[model samples]
Target: MAEAGEGRYEIASVISRSFETVRSNLGLFAGLALILSGVPAFALNLWQTSFGVNLNAAQPDFSALLSAAYLGPLFVGWLVAMVTNAVLQASLTRATVTHLSGEKPVFAQCLTVGVSMILPMIGIGILLALGVGLAMLLLIVPGIILWLCWSVVVPVYVQEKVGVIEAFGRSMALTEGSRWRIFLTMLLVLVGLWLLSIPVGLLTVAVAATGSVIAVSLVTAIVSALGSMVMVTVQSCVYVELRNVKEGVAPADLEAIFA
Candidate 1:
């Protein structure tokens, strides 16, 4: 296998290493996915499709749609899920970095690192969202371009410990000559996930037909969490490779950040 620090990496290696990392950390990652993503997804879906209905009516009560009681818990859950996902991302970044550096990762320590970094992550996310949203509004091509450029921002932020704004610049710097490669990798990952979801989609339909919203929601959440894990694993690998190429920073250096 080619070393990652050679300023070159095969897509196959990144994918293989990612799977290996996730498999090795499956227990912790699974718990993170379930609590941080799956539970919230299940809860929100169940509330909306099951407990949310007016018991006195055959259909949803249109008048009550805008009521505080209807939206409050759901919104709260959504916010919580958002925060939980950010923390999960940070935790995964830390886990991957440490593991690659030959250290055993602790879930609690990752969680703590995640919690500390949550606010900055949120700030960068909002900035990126607005940038992408505005570019998308203009024509859509620019948005895609921007998306590719910023694809590794979270990993950049988490790994570098730079300021939120600096992370954007750092990502752009690292991705300068490699945007096409990054875009193609992202495209492949998305297409692969979409293909995998076909069977999952059919299963969801079957579950929905059974008239059990909980079952359908559970399946959806699990699939979504799985997707999240795959995406983050790829991202963390990419970030490591990028740093190795651009700065000659080895995995051992990254491990020392947490040491």
Candidate 2:
């Protein structure tokens, strides 16, 4: 809703709407996030802590860290984390879209959609990670640019039911005229999250010092879940706003697609 020109969205509007969506659907978002992200994170943290690996120590025991026992669970945990995150993203997108359309988002429906889209979402996630990660290795600018372009790929895939490659193309097209604003929006959100994490990080360290790995991991998992909820909701909001600006598609129109 910027008057600057067609296909341009307001940064403040997107940010405000994103937070409002999360606030309004607090219970739903938190529940999905805890189930999808928090549990897995806690399990992974417990596994890591059990190894008694002091990664923070100077000249730590690389041999113990690189052993099969450590590396195997680490890989599996990472894989699970990735898949769960994809599901969470898809579910949150569904919920956010439904809410925007003035319909009450059903938790079961959102979760079903998320589960059904898991394979493609995972594929898209992998491709995005590889493409952006390689770009970052070459130059930071290109990575950031690619991230901005493909930021809404998951939502596009979820809503449009497109092939993985097509989702990337559609997202790039939707984000074409609004990358600058999108970049600023992302920067502000990230900065705010970083500032908020300061206290949470301190609390984490304090808990770790108490020799209570379970407590520390629980706190960490909760924080991660909340962070994921906010970020995923923001992504959904961005996708909704971009479609409105570029394609003139209203939330009601999108809602009917699911009907």
Instruction: Give each model's whole-structure lDDT.
Output: 0.81, 0.89
What is the per-residue lDDT of model 1 for residues 1-259, given as tens digits with 9 covering 90 to 100?
2335457645666677777888999998787777777888888877877755755677767766777888798789878887888888888888888888888889899888889988887777789889999999999899998987787899888877778888888888877666777777777888999999999999999988998877987998899888897898788887887777767887778767634
lDDT, candidate 2, 137-231, per-residue tens: 99999999999999999888888888899999999888887888899888899899999999999999999899998999899999999998988
Alpha-carbon runs more than 4 Å astray in model 2: 1-7
Q: RMSD to native for every prediction?
A: 4.0, 2.0
The collision pairs in model 1 are none
Question: What TM-score would each prediction reach against the true structure?
Answer: 0.88, 0.95
Candidate 2, residue 127: how far the Cα is off, in Å:
0.6
TM-score of 2: 0.95
What candidate 1 gets wrong by more than 4 Å, as runs, is 1-6, 51-65, 257-259
